[model samples]
Each structure stands twice: as structure tokens, then as C-alpha cells.
Target chain A: MITIRIPTPLRSMTGGKSEIEGKGASIGELIEQMNADHPGLKDRLCDEQGEIRRFINVYLNEEDIRFLTGKDTPVKDGDEVSIVPAIAGGAHD
Target chain B: MFIIPSDIWEDMIDHARGHAPRECCGMLAGTDNRVTRQYRITNILAKLNEAELARFDQPKLSDLKQLAPEERADIAFQMDARELSQAQKDIRQRGIELQAFYHSHTMSPARPSATDITLAMEFEHCRAALNLPQPLHVIVSLEDRDHPVMRAYRIEASRATEVPVRRQ
Candidate 1:
């Protein structure tokens, strides 16, 4: 089981659980496991194309998964995965 | 109701002023509804390259890819992801939660504009989906350079209800 830390914004879906255990060989599968336990969690973190949303950042063991293989980044028991939403907006039309 | 002390209040104003035509943004963090600190986030508009811009699915942001880099910041702000992640961590470590997300409206009123409302609703959806408290959306209108106005709102169900704001 991989240790996944949920951000405050995304915790509601996790039943307010900050840390959740997921079983997967990669970040992609981990998300599947998590979404199974907490439905709709994937929509907020990923887009329709299954790519990580631009507004959300995922880190694998303190290193951004983007620096790794993104959703395919390998994970193992005891690995740490975290989600952080990008705080962004504006007054644009 | 949101009560902002004079110091943080002034800092927000100063941050908006300092950025001028370019909007400034930040987060308000606090414990027990009492705001304690503000984290200013850099707008990474100017740093966004074509490839990155194309990835923004938000209509308002995607629409900006046509505009010149200098002109884009005038109407929009996209926070630096690294800064945003760090701010959230720091606030958590400080034993407080991020209570509000704020940004300057360089040419509009200190109210949630259409774009702001739309985005706020998306966040509201996430908040509601998990039954979490929805954070406030604070806007500082710098339309009148000298007398900037700040306001806060609770965006729910696609509607924005103005919340009382006070400077302590």
C-alpha cells in the first residue's frame, strides 16, 4: 500500500482523511484504487483525457510526478504520494 | 464575516498596488475563522510559454493564448504552481487552513466577476462533493488606483453572496 496525502481541498472526497492507503504499481493505478474507495476523486485531479489537470499538482515522494513519468510513475509499498491544487484565478473575461 | 487586521489588509492593498496593471493574488490562512496570515502568489502569466498556454482548458485562460504576453497579465493571473504548493504546506504546518483565495481586479469592481464566479463554482463543486467548507473568494478592485476596494463572497451553487468584510 502506498501512502497518499490528500490536500485540504480534496479531502472532502476522502472523507476528510488526509492520508489514504492505496495499492498500485504506479500513480495511475493508485488513483484508480483511490477513486474506487472515494468516487469522483479523479475528476478533480485529472482531466477528461486522463492527464493530470493543469490546476492540480501531484508529487511522488516530494518530487513532482511531472519530473518523473507523470501518472505512470512507479510506486511501491510505503511510497508517499501527494495532491496539491494550484491556487489560481483572475478577473479575465 | 471576515475580519482582516490593518496589517494584512494593508499588505493586500500594497500587493495589489505594487503589481499595478498586472493582478496580484494570494491566500488567506487562519484558524477558527480568524485570519492570521496572507501568502502572496506570483502570477506566472508572463512565464507561460505557448505549449503551457495551450494546455489551459479554462475558456478565459485558453482565450489568452491569442494575446501578447504583456497584455495577458492585465486581465488574468495564473499562480506559480510551486509557490501555491509551498504556501499550502506552510499554512498547514502553521496549524491553519487556507480560508480564502484572493486576487486583484485591475479594471473591475471588488466583486466576483463572471470569470471569477465560474471558477469559484468549480471549486465550490469540489468543496461540496466532499462536504468541506467552501473557502471565501476575495477580490480587491484597483479600478480607482487611489481608493482600492476589497470585498469577499461565498460562492455557492453558481451564485455569489457578498459577505461582510471589516478592517480591524
Candidate 2:
């Protein structure tokens, strides 16, 4: 199980809880399993291509997973995952 | 509606003025719909790295790379990602909510443009991510230069409705 820190914006979807625990072997699986438990979460975080939307930042512990392996980044029990909104410019995504 | 203290309101204007043609972006943290603390973040408008882009994903981004760095910031603004993430953690630690996101419109009106509207709507899709019925985006327009105008907006579902910004 991994500990995921939910941002305030996504809190309503999580029943207003700021943090929750879920299961997954990698960051990708974790989002799927967590979405199974939370519902609609994976959709908010992942796009149709199964890629983490560029406007959404996912951090594994203190480092943004983008700088690492992105959604493919492996995860294990007790790891911390934090999701926050990223604002971008130019035409919409 | 968003209530901003006088000092913070002035600071936002000053931040916009200081940046001039370049857009200035930051976050506002507070309780309820009133602002208490303002964070001035470094705008990485023209500092995007290749990792952040995927194959000329957005035409504007690709076009942005064509402009001279100084002229680049004028077309758009994006806050430094690491700084924003760190700021969120700090804001949470202080027990205050991040009430709104703010930026300057150096050449346009205080109202959101199509791209700004799209940006806000993209943010809106977070599903009440801010725990507010609509996410608030405050824009300061330096179009007049001599008289900077600021306005508040509630952006959702591709719509941007003007909300009063009171300087208390």
C-alpha cells in the first residue's frame, strides 16, 4: 500500500479526505487501483492516452515523477504520492 | 467574490508593474474567499525544457520557442513548477487554503481571453479541486499602463463570469 496525499481541489472526490492509502506495484497501477477505490480519480489524473496530464503534477515523495519515469515509475508500499495542479500557458491541452 | 486586503492588493499590482511586458504569476493563500498571504513566484514563461513538451504538443509552445527570450514571456506565463509545488506544501503547513491563482495580462484586458479561459477551464476540470464551487482566477491587466485594472473571475465549464474583487 502507498500513501497518497490528495490536494484540496480533488478532496471532494475523496470524500474530503486529504490523505488515503491504496495498493499498486507501480505509479500507473497505483492510480488504477486507487481509482477503483475512489472512482473518477484516475480519469482526473490520467488522460485517454493513459498519460498523466501535463497540467497535473504527480510527485513520488518529494520529487516530481516526470523528472523520473512518469507514470511508469515503480512504487512500493509506504511510498508517498502527492498530486497537485500545474498551470500552463499557450493553447489548451 | 474575493476579498483582498489593501496591502496584498497593492502588492499584486506592484508585482505586475515590476514585471511589465512580461506576465507575472503567483498564488493567493487565505481562508474562505478572502486573501491573506500572496506568494510571488518566478515566472518560467520562456524557460520551458524539452521534457515538459511532447513533440510540439501545442502550437503556441512551439512558436514560443521561436521568439527571443525577452519577447517570449509576453506571449504567456507559467510559474516555476518546483517552486509552486514547494509553495503548496508551505501554504498547507500554515493551515491556510490556497484561495486563488493570479497573473498579469500585460497586453489584454483584465477579462480572460480564449486561451486564459481555456486555461481556467482546464483548471476547473479538477472537479472543484479548490473545494470551491468555481476556481477563482484573478487577473491584473496592465493594458492601460498608467491605470492597471484588476478583476476576479469564476471559471468553470469554459465559462468565465466576472466576480467582484474587493480591496478591503
Candidate 3:
């Protein structure tokens, strides 16, 4: 089982569970299984094209998936995944 | 509401003045809704990705890519993640929590703009990952240059609620 860490904003949908365990062999599979258990989770994690949102960063064991193999990044049992959103703004005025 | 000592309050104003024309950003740390310390962070506003930039002004990605960090600092602000982590650690060591994140709005009002509100919402979304409280977003508007207006608010989702600030 791989552990997925959910961010705060999306926590309201997961009943405030900070972390959850799911079964998957890759990052994509992990998100798929986790979303099956927690509906709407997939929408927040991915777009209509099934691509990770640009603002969201996912790291596997401290390595950014984007720099790795992306969704195809392999995930083994006991691996930890974290989802982080970019906090930015102030372009007005 | 936030209680800011007179000297500290002045410092914030001065900071805004020092960075006039450009936005300055920092985090305030304190307890009981009172600010005790302020951490000035380097604003990397123009360094943000294209997707985030598109929501604000229509600065072509090509144009932004051509300018340097110093040039970009004039219109946007971004806090370095490493510096933020260090500040958070120092604040925790001082036994104080991060109370608010403040930024200067050189050309806007003392209220959060649509972009600011979106960022504040993102801040709330990312707070748990940082183990910090939902910060009161503070804006220092320097539209007049001579007179500045500072206001605080709790921005959630798309709504903002003003939090009165008292000068102690």
C-alpha cells in the first residue's frame, strides 16, 4: 500500500483525513484507486484530459514526479506521495 | 482583528515606502492576534509560471521570459519557499505562530483583489502542508504614496471578511 497525503483545501471532501492508503503500482494507478474510494478526488488532482493540474505538485518520496516519469512514475509499497498547491498572486495594480 | 505595536506598524509602512512602485511581502508572527515579529521575504513575483501569470495582467509569456527578476519585481511578488521554511522555523523557535502574510498593493486598494483572493484561497489550501494556521491576509495600499492604507482580512474560498487592525 502507498500512502497519499492530501492537502488542506481538499481535505473537506476527504472528511479531513490528512493521509490515506491505497493500492497501486504507479502514481497514476494510486490516484485512480484513491479517487475510486473518494469520489471527486480525481477531478481536483487531474483535469478533463487526465493531466495533473499545473498548479498542483506531486512528490513521491520527496522527488517531484514532473521531473521524474510523471504519472507513469513507479510507486512501490510503503512509498509516500504528497500533493502540494502553489501559493501565489499579486499581479493586479 | 490584529493588534500591531506602533513601532512595528511604522516599520511596515516604511517597508512599503522602501519598495514603492513594487510590492513588498512578508509574514508576521505573533500570538493572541498580536504581531510580535515580521519576516521580510524576497518577492519573486515575476518568476511565477505562465499559468499563474495569465490570471493577472496580460503580460505575454515571451515578454516575461525576456525580463530579469529585478524587472519582474515591479508588478508581481513571489516568496521563496526555502526562505519561508526558514522563517517558519525561526518563528516556531520563538514560540510564536505565523499570524498574517502581508503585501503592498502599490496601485490597488487595501482590499484583496480577485488574484489576491485566489492566492489567499491557495494559501488556505496549502496551510495544512506547512502546519500553519489560516493566516489573515493583509494588504498595504500605497496608491497615494504619501498616505498608505493597511487592512487585514480572512480570505476563504472566494469571500473575504475584514479583520480590524488596532495600532497598539
Candidate 4:
């Protein structure tokens, strides 16, 4: 089972669970499984062109998936996936 | 010339403080001496790895200790092209001129660092119209709110000017 960490903005879709477990041999499969389970998360994860959005980053065990094999990056049981979106706002006075 | 609003400047300072220990980068935008918009570009903190941090040199204790003040100031205007391009494009698309690049100097004086000066110099070299009438370099140090220093300068002649930038 691969554990997928959900970001704050998308947590509502996952019923507020910070992390969810799924079965997949690769990043693509993991996302596909997530979409099947969550129903509306796929659209948020991928843009209209089906490409990953520029502001969102996905990491497999702290390593950016983009630097890996991208969507084809392999995953195994007990692997951890983290999703982080760039945050904006706030400055010191 | 673009002017950054006080509120936005405050927001940027807050963002910088929140990301303390690492630098925060963003774009400043405005038209004709006023900055109406600001975009948080990226968090450099998110990109650093253990190996990179291990090799990090503290600016306060670096070879800068042996350099003349003028030489040290000159080094602050250089910046990376890719980062400049990203900032420029973001501002341009919004119909705002690329006024200045702003970043926080966490754990250090709010003054422009050697890296900042290098970026400013690079920007002046790559951009056309050196004769354009506007201040291209802006440095804001959030150390003291009452007298938060905002210095403006032209990168070509290396002349400094003091301008009042109101933060809301």
C-alpha cells in the first residue's frame, strides 16, 4: 500500500484525511486509483491538457517526481507520496 | 518607474518572516512609478537539499570581510536570468512593468546582499534603453518598521536615490 499525502486545499476531497493509502505500482496508477476513489480529485491534480499543474509538486519519499520518471515513476508497498502546492500571502511589517 | 504599495510590501515582509531561515522570492509590478501588484514567485527554501545546505556559506563570515564597501555593493546587483525571466513574464502579462525584484534577507540585515546587487547589474545589462528615466533597483530591509529602509538606484551609473514607498 502506498500512502498519499493530501495538501490542505485538496483535503476536503479526501474527507480531510492528511494521508490516504492506495494500491499502485507507479505514480500514474496511484493517481488513477485516487481519482477512482475520490471522484473529483483528478481534475484538480491535472490541468485541462491532462498535464500536472505547474504550481503543484508531487514527491515520492521526499524526491520530486518530476526529476524521477515523472508519471511513470515506480512505487512500491509502504512508499510515501507527498503533494505540496505553492503557497502565497503574508510579509513582515 | 513603478511604486510598490505599502500593503503589498507589508505582505511581502510577512511572507519573508514566515519563511525565516531561507529566502523568499517574488515579483513587484506597477506602471509609471507605482507598483499595483505583487506575485510570490517561488520559495527557495523548498528547493534546498541537505547537500546544498551543507555547502552553504554565511554571508556575514565570508570573503566579503576583506572586500571594500564599494566593491561589495557592486556585487549585489547580479541575479540569475531564468529567475529574472520568470519575474518579467509574470509582470508583463498583467500589463505591469517589471519594476524591481524583491527577496527577504532573513537572519541578516535587510540591506541588499552581494547576490541581490549582482542580479540588479545583470538586469540593467540585459534590458535595453539605459537612458530610460526610472529607478531599476529597489532594496527593502524589514529590520525596523518605523524606519524600514527602501533604497532605489539605477544600475548603469550606480547612483542612489531615496524614494518614499508607502506600505499599507
List the DockQ of the predictions in order.
Answer: 0.25, 0.18, 0.23, 0.02
| Alpha-carbon RMSD of each model | 6.8, 7.8, 7.3, 16.0
Model 1 misplaced stretches (Cα beyond 4 Å): A1-24, A28-55, A59-85, B50-63, B127-133
Give stretches of model 3 more than 4 Å off. A6-86, A91-93, B48-71
TM-score of chain A of 4: 0.91
How much is the lDDT of residue B47 in candidate 2? 54
Candidate 2 deviant stretches above 4 angstroms: A1-56, A60-85, A90-93, B50-59, B62-66, B127-134
lDDT ranking, high to low: 1, 3, 2, 4
Report the lDDT tens digits of candidate 1 across residue range B1-168: 798889999999999999989889888988655689999998877766665554344677666877899888778777766676677678767878878889999998898777677656645543433323468989999999889999999888778899998898
- Better model by DockQ: candidate 1 vs candidate 3: 1
* Ten-residue stretch with the least lDDT total in model 3 chain B: B52-61
Ranking 2 against 4 by lDDT, winner: 2
Per-candidate TM-scores read: 0.70, 0.67, 0.67, 0.44
Best lDDT among the predictions, by candidate number: 1
Q: Which stretch of 10 consecutive residues in model 1 chain A shows the poorest summed lDDT?
A: A84-93
DockQ, ranked from best to worst: 1, 3, 2, 4
Model number with the top DockQ: 1
Question: Is 1 or 3 the stronger prediction by lDDT?
Answer: 1
Error of 3 at B114 (Å): 0.3
Candidates 1 and 2: which is better by lDDT? 1
- Pick out the ten consecutive residues of candidate 2 chain A with the lowest summed lDDT: A84-93
Q: How close is chain A of candidate 2 to the true chain A, as a TM-score?
A: 0.87
lDDT of 4 at B4: 63
The alpha-carbon lDDT assigned to residue B133 of candidate 4 equals: 29
